[model samples]
Target chain A: MEDVEAQTHLIGDSGEDPIISKIALAEVQRAIDSLPQEQREVLALVCGEDLTYREAAEVLNVPIGTVMSRLARARRRLVEMTAAA
Target chain B: MSELHLTDEILMAFADGELDQPVAAAVARVMAQDPAVARKIVEFQQSRRLTRSVFANNLAPDVPSELRAAISAKIEAYEAAVEGGEGKQAKETKSIWGGGMSPVRMALAASLAAVAVSAAYFIGQHSQSEVGRLAQLEHPRVLQELSRLESGRDAELPFGRLRVISTYRLPDNSLCREFRLQSTSTSTDAVACRTDGWRVTFALSDPAKGAEYVPSSGGDLLESYLDNLGAGNPLEGEAEAKALSETAR
Candidate 1:
């Protein structure tokens, strides 16, 4: 029952009030903590620090494609998690 | 319409300001009316703001001398390694190639399809010189996803910058802990295990931006740990604040 509710919460579409926003942020952070090392690092470079994808690629010293692919997977996972949470 | 099929990646890019002007404007139009898309955008924006706000305080203090000294030592070592002779040029060339055949050339190499796919692709790789284990611990799938789109807090987190910046404990009383993670380029979630369950605290701060985290003693970590620990209700206000201040400082 709790799991089902949690699943429903993940896909919720309500606008976030400040109180809800705080909970969502906490959930997001928790989601981030769960990612693969490389994926987490890339997410941080692009999302956390406000770097251009190109700049992030340069920083990580990996191919831009790798960055993109990893990011895609990472984002997909987040969306799923968000939907679930 | 098939032509208007926008992926979540593009929507996220638009939210993150990774879109070029024209592309961003195009997505903005779609988002204005699409409630689902709009919510995702709002979530992204809010998360970004909170991350910035949380870590912004760490920048207030001067770079601890210890951190600066350590980075300097590494830099000098790097210089010495390069100056040490014949092997230097090879290493430099390798780093450049490793950095990827130059971004300018790569951009020019792209086809139209590739250009269209730009926002969805484009992740930054780790530097070859980075040492230590790329330790990505296990987490619930939902939290795992958030790690991807979110980067570290600051600009250029210098290397080897760790300090026992704060501590926190949970009301559940499973555990209390303090950590000294690096101020730059390090994002980790730590959980001090409790008997009823584990009370975890995660930090995502970048020294480059001078971001300092506001201790979330009973915030997400306590609840999360409890969830994982398979016991009890979450912590609230006074206890939460007390646990955070007690452990983080």
Candidate 2:
């Protein structure tokens, strides 16, 4: 997560002031890291690698519906985390 | 459907590009009418971007030397097994490398495969002409050429060969055509539909993997996109001919 804080300085285009964007990005990274391992894995595979849900299911060895449910839960959790932040 | 009626699953699918066309369009229409739904969609997209950024920050600068050695040894073993007619061993080795590996390791391996494919295609091959044409997707001439091919024109351009792979009508009753462009160095698969003119909905390019490159019609991304759009089986033979004739008008 320290690496995330360091890298956030380079993330632009958020329309917020540069310092504010970096802080927001760092907070989001912390929120993601706090997720359960399974949720984090699903989120990483789909969002990070650009895999479709079916492809992510194949990789995670789960059913497609499971992938959808996990992803939905993971996303919902992130929204809640960010809103609280 | 009302914006208030939209479910989390549906909104997530739309953000992830999982919804079919009509459903996606309906979502879009609702978003236009509902600020809350639109804001949620934006939040979903931002979350995805943030998640990806975090992972991107974590990527190792280099592959571990031991992993490289393992890959090389595996390849050598695969070759030896092939020579010895031990097909089972080769299959076992592939499974061990592909299925048994960690997700990050698997992604690294996939990138290596893509690099190999790209290297094979780009070496000593002239790609400018083909790549240039593909980059001109919005040009009037390119659209005209696409339209001609969709309507059964079989003329070859200097860039390479072009042919329609499939044609389908969207829920809006608009006609779309999936086509392939094969050149010496690269191959592209694209979908364009007749709106005010031909508008490209999707396009993917790969280095020439063999003597010819034919993108699988059921490629994961394309399949997901088609599923979201509620696209049906591609028109073929007489159906394709009929769709082409209709588009001509």
Give the candidate number with the greatest lDDT: 2
- lDDT agreement with native, every candidate: 0.38, 0.54
TM-score of each: 0.35, 0.43
> TM-score of chain A for each candidate?
0.74, 0.75
Identify the leading candidate in terms of TM-score. Answer: 2
What is candidate 2's CAPRI-style docking category based on DockQ?
incorrect
Q: What residue pairs clash in candidate 2, if any at all?
A: B19-B228, B20-B227, B20-B228, B20-B229, B21-B228, B21-B229, B21-B230
| Residue lDDT tens for model 2, B122-152 | 2212346433644654456556666555444
Fnat measured on candidate 1:
0.09
Model 2 chain B scores worst on lDDT over the 10 consecutive residues at B105-114
Residue lDDT tens for model 1, B1-249? 345567756765655556665566456434533546555554444343333322221211123355435433433444465577622221121111112221111111122212211211111112231113123211232122222111222222233322222223333354333233342445433333323322222222221121112123323432332333233443345554454443323
